[model samples]
Target: MRFSLWQPGRLLSKKNVKGWVRLTLGDMGGFRNMKSKWAGKTWGTLGDSITAANGYQPLVQDALGFSRVHNYGVGGCPMTAGGERDYGATTHVGRSIENTLDCVTIFAGVNDFRLDKPLGAIGTLDPCTFYGAYASLIEDILVKNPLCRLNLWTPLHRDKDGYDIHYVNAAGYRLCDYAEAVAALGRIYALPVLDLYAQSGLNKLTLSNFTTDGLHPNEAGHRRIADMAISFLRGL
Candidate 1:
C-alpha cells in the first residue's frame, strides 16, 4: 500500500512524485559514489540508542578488521543540532572531529523523525533542521578530514503498536521522509548510502526475531545489521 501524506499540503506533488520514482539516486548526475575498500580503515560511528547499545559496531569492525573504532552514539539522540547534552549528531560528531577517522558511518534520523524535529529545506546547511544538520555534519567531516570516507545509513523499520514504517509523526512526516532525506543528502554529497530502512528487511513479521521491542534490534538483529553493513562497507 502506498501512502501520500506529505505535510503543509503536497510536499511532493504528483508530478514530483512521479519524477522521484523515475529517478535512480545512485545513477543521478554528479554523484561520485563513495565506494572504497574499508578493511583496516579507522572507523567512527555516530547515532542514537541502538548504536549506543553497542550491538552491531563490534561485529562490523571484527569482520572488516578496522584498525580502530570510535563509538560516538548516545541514546535518545537526534540528528538535528541543539544545546549541550542534547545528544545531537552535530554535538556527538565533534568527539572524533579531530581524529580524522579514515571512515565514518552515520546511522541516524529515527530520533529526529520520532521526535518530529523540523526537517529543514533540502540543500540548506543549517544545524537547526534535520537535513541541514546532516548536510552541515557531512560538510564538516569532509572539510576537516579531507581523506575521510563517509556513509549514511537510513533509520530501520519501526513497528511499535502505534508506529510503523508508515506512521506519520506530529510533524506531518513519515519515517520514509527521513529515510529519503538521507538518500537525498547522499546524492547531493556524492557519498554512498546504506539504505537500511528499505534494505534492513525488518518488518512486522520479522520484528520479534530481529528486534527486542519493535524499535531496537536484538543480538540477531544486530548480526543482521552487521551482515548488511559488512557487505555495504566492503563494496563501497
Candidate 2:
C-alpha cells in the first residue's frame, strides 16, 4: 500500500509524491488560525507551526518507506489534560481512545512554555498541573496502548525577542528550562527524546529565516525538522 505512492508508471516524481503525503497529513495536524483574549487582550495562536509535520510520525513513515501518516497534533493546545484551562480534553482532535498507534510522540509544552509557568518537579504534584499534565497524558497513552513506542520531543528554539515578548518567569526561568524539563521527564521514563530546542540550529538571528513570526516555523524550518525526525525515527 505504501509503495503505491511511488509507482514508476505514475507521472509524479518521488519528491512530489512524498510532498502529497505531507500535504494530506498537514491538515490532519490541526494547523489553526485563531485569536482570543487571555489577560484582557487578544492572544493569537501559532497558526503555521509544523511540529506535527516535522514530528516523528510522518518522518518515520517516509523513512520506513510508507506514504501515509497519522498525526494527532492539535494547534494552540497545551498538554494540561485536567488542569487549569483543561485544553487537553477537547484538543485531542485525531487521537482516539480505542485506536492503537504504532508510535506516540509527546511534542507538547510550547503553549505551556509561552504561558511561562514555573517548572515543577515531576510526579510530585497533581497530574493535571503544569509538568504533571505531561505525565498524566503519557500515563494515559501508555495505559491505553502499552505496545506502542513513545518518544518525547522538545520544541525548537524560539527567537530571543519572541521569547521575551511571550514568556516570563519571576525566578528567571527561560524557554530552555521547559526543554530541560522535557528531557528530564524523558530520562525518568526512559523514553527517547528529540531535543529540537538544543539540537535545531535556530537562534534569535536566524529564527526569522526559519520561522514565520519568530515562533512558528516556516517551510525551511519544517524541512530541517523533518530531516532530524527522519533520522531519529530511523534510528529507533
Candidate 3:
C-alpha cells in the first residue's frame, strides 16, 4: 500500500489513489510562516557527544537558542558504512526519519579507522571508498527529505601513539586525509562540512580535557565542541 499527503483544501480522496488517506487542517500558510522560534536560531547535533558528558544539551540550548535538539550518536559507530550486520546495529543511518530536523550533524569514521585486532587486523578505509559510501548515505537521506540541512563532521584528531593509531599508520590515513575527504564529499553534495578535526583544540588543551580513557572527550571537551558548532551555525 502507498501513503500520500492530504493537501489542505484539496479533496481528501480521488479515484486515482487506492490506499488510505488522512486529512488535516491544510497548510493555512502557517507552516511557511512558522519559524522554528529557533530558526536561523536553533542548532542540533547527533553523535557520541552524549558519551562525553559535555553538558552539550544545555550549552547548545543556551548558546545557540536551540530548545529542541536530538542526539543520536552512539559510541563505536562508524558512519554506518560497514553494513547493519556489523557494529551491533546501533548506527542511525538505517533508522526511519522521525521529525523534520533543521540541522543534522554526523560524527563518524573513528571506529572505521580503529578496527585493530590480533593477527595484524586493522580498519581498511580508503578515502575514495568512504566517500562513495558516505555519498550514498547522504543521497538516501536527501531522497527522504530534501529540506533537511546536513552538517558532516570530519573525524577528530588522534596522536601517533593512540590505541587506534595502527589503523591510521597502516592505511596512511592521517587526520588531514580524513578532513579533506569529508570536505570533498561536502562540496560535491553541497552540504555544510564542519572541520572538527582542525577546529577542535583538544590537543592544545591539557589531558584533563579528555575522558579518563584518553579517547572520548570530558565535559569540558563537549562544551568546546558545542561552542564551536554553535559558532559555525551562527555564521551560516
Candidate 4:
C-alpha cells in the first residue's frame, strides 16, 4: 500500500512509522528508496544530497554490503556536521554509530555553496562554518571507527531550477569549485573521493532521465549512484 498522508490513521498504523515519516517530510515523491522498510541487517548512511537522496533506501547499503541503514540527510544541510545547521549529520552520526560500519559515505557541501557561506578552512578553530563542520564530522568518524572504510562523494552537477540559481557561490564560484574543495579535503584526509560532478553525467542535456529537479536525482540517478558505490567498494 502507498503511504497516504491524507490517511493519518493508516500512516500511524504502519509498523515502521519513521520510514513513512521520512518519506513524507523529505519530499520523496519519486519511487526509488521507498520500497523497503530497513527491517533487518546492519550498516548506515549519513550526509546530504545523494547520500540521503532516495529517502531511506538500501540502495547504497546493499551496494556496499551493509545490514541496516540509517539516513541522516536533512534538506538544505551542508556537511556542517551539525552545529549552526543543527539538523545535519554531525548532530547525529556519532550517536548513530552503534557498531563498526563496513562503509560510510558522505555527499554534502552543495548547500553550503548554494547558501553562499564562506568555505572555512579545514582546521579552522571555528567549528560552525562550512569547512569546519565537515572537518568535525571526519574527526568524529575516525575517533569512533578508524577501521570503517570512508568515501566522500562530490556534489552532482545541478543546473538552475526555473529562475533560481542552483549552486553558485557569492564571488560567482561555480559548483565545480565546491566540488574541488571536497576533493581537496578528501586528499588531505586520505579518503577515497568519488568525483560525481565530473563523472555522474547528470548535465543539462541528460538531466531529465536522472533527476526530478535539477538538484535531486530520480530513480535512475540513484541507481547510478548505487552502481558507482558498488564499484568503488569492490575495487577497495
Candidate 5:
C-alpha cells in the first residue's frame, strides 16, 4: 500500500489498523505479499537505517507489496557492538525488531565498526557474544510465532571511497568477518542468512550511487539493496 508521512491521522484509520512497524534507518512497507495481524503495530526504530532519499516504506511496498510501513533507523547505530556502556543494552534486538514480526531481517554493525571514531573502531566480535543475542532474537520470534522465519544479512565491504579519512579504516576487520559471524549464528539456529554483502559488491558502487555524505546510499543504493533483497527472497 502507498503511504506518506503527511497523513499521521490515517495511522489510526480502520483501513490502516495493522499497527505501524518502525525501522532504525529506513521507512517500512516492503511485505506486499506478506500480511500481519500486527500491521501498524507501534514501533520504535532505533538505528540509522532510514534517510530522506530511501525510506523503508516505499522499499517495503515495492519489495513485499505491503500497503503501510513505519521506520526508525537511527543514522549511527552499532550492530554488533552496543553503544555507550549504559546504552549498549539498547540495541535493535532489544528495542523493536524483536516484537515487530514473525520474520525479521537485521542489517547493522557498519556503524559500530566505523573506523573514524576511536570508540567506533572495528573490533573482533566474539561469536559467543553475538551468537547468544542472535539466537535469542530468533527464539523470541519463534516463541511468539513458531513458524516464523528470520533473515540475517551481513555488512558489505566498505566502498572504495570508504577508505578516506572520513570513512572507517579498511584495515581494521573485514566486512566478511562480520558476515561470517552472522552466518555462523544463522547455522546455529537454522535460520536463513542472506549474505548480500558477498553476493553484491556494494562497496564497489560509484559515488553517484551513494549519498552526498559518502556513507549511506542514495536512491540508487537503496534500489540496489532492494533488488538484492528481492533476489535473495526469490531464491528461497
Candidate 6:
C-alpha cells in the first residue's frame, strides 16, 4: 500500500517525486489518505471576491492533491443578476459550470447582499433573482455534469450588508437568510453544504484577524478556508 508520491528512501529530495509532494503539501496530517481521494480529480471554484482573490486555491490544491483547481470566480459577481442590477462584464455562470470537472465549489451570495440584490422565492426560475439564480445554476450543473459532485459554501461573515449576520440588508433580508437559502438549495440538490458562516469562527469583531477588507480573506484566512474545504471534500 505505497503511494506513488512518497517512499522510504525519498524522504526529502526536492527534485524527486516524493520531495515534490512533500515540499508542495507541507506538514498537513493525514496527507496521504486525503491526497489519495482527490489525487486524480479536477476542481472548479465559483464565487465573488473571496473566490476571485489569489487565495485558497493553491492551498486547496496542495492539501487535497487535486490535479487541477481552476478559478471561475469573478470579483463583483453575484449569484443573481436580477434585471435591476447591471452586472456589466462579470457573472457567476462561467466555463466551470459548463465543463466536465470532477467537482465544483460555489462560494457566492456576498455580492448579492452587498449589492442589495432582491431575494426571489425558492423555486424561482429567474437567474436574475437570488433564489431563481441558484435554481437555474444547480439545474444546469446537474445537466452538464451528471457524474460531477458539487459543494455549496455559504458566504463568510462580513459587514458588507450589515455588521451583524442578523442585520437586514437594503433588500430587507438578513445575511443569515441568504446563508440559509444556500443550505436549503443544497438539500434540494442533495449536495453537501459547508456552512462557513456558522463554522469559520469569523465574525465582525474578529474581522481584522482573518480578512483584509472585512470581506475578502487574507493569507491566514485563505489557509483556514483551504483547511475546511480539504476536510469537507475528503469526508465527501
Which of the numbered candidates is closest to the native, going by highest lDDT?
A: 1
Model 1 clash count equals: 2
RMSD of each candidate? 16.5, 12.1, 14.2, 12.9, 11.8, 6.3
Best by TM-score: 6
Off-target runs (Cα >4 Å) in candidate 3 are: 1-44, 49-54, 83-95, 116-129, 159-161, 164-170, 204-207
Error of 3 at 144 (Å): 1.5
Q: Where does model 1 exceed 4 Å of error?
A: 1-37, 83-87, 90-92
lDDT of 6 by residue, 114-158 (tens): 777777898776777778888777777878787888889998988
Which candidate, 1 or 6, would have the higher lDDT against the true structure?
A: 1
Positional deviation of 12 in candidate 5, in angstroms?
Answer: 46
- Scored by Cα lDDT, where does model 1 land? 0.80
Steric collisions counted per model: 2, 0, 2, 5, 40, 1
What local distance difference test score does each model get?
A: 0.80, 0.58, 0.55, 0.64, 0.49, 0.77
Task: Give per-residue lDDT, candidate 3, residue 119.
Answer: 14
> For residues 34-149, what per-residue lDDT tens digits would candidate 1 score against the true structure?
23355557988888988888899988876677768888887877888774535556434654555568888888988887777778799897887888888888887888887887
Q: What is the full ranking by TM-score, best candidate first?
A: 6, 1, 4, 2, 3, 5
Q: Quote each prediction's TM-score.
A: 0.80, 0.67, 0.65, 0.71, 0.60, 0.81
What lDDT score goes with residue 53 in model 2?
A: 44
Query: How much is the lDDT of residue 77 in candidate 6?
Result: 67
- Candidate 4, after superposition: displacement of residue 172 in Å? 4.9
User: How many residue-pair clashes does candidate 5 contain?
Assistant: 40
Ten-residue region with minimum lDDT total, candidate 1: 27-36
Model 5 local distance difference test score: 0.49
Better of 2 and 3 by TM-score: 2
lDDT of 3 by residue, 1-236 (tens): 33355666665565655775643445422343243344443334545533224365666565555646665655555543444424422234424444467666666655545542111111222223455545665665677757777778776665434633224434556445556666877887888887877777655344355544556666776677678876776565
For model 5 the local lDDT of residue 176 reads 54
TM-score of 2: 0.67
Alpha carbon deviation, residue 211, candidate 5 (Å): 4.0
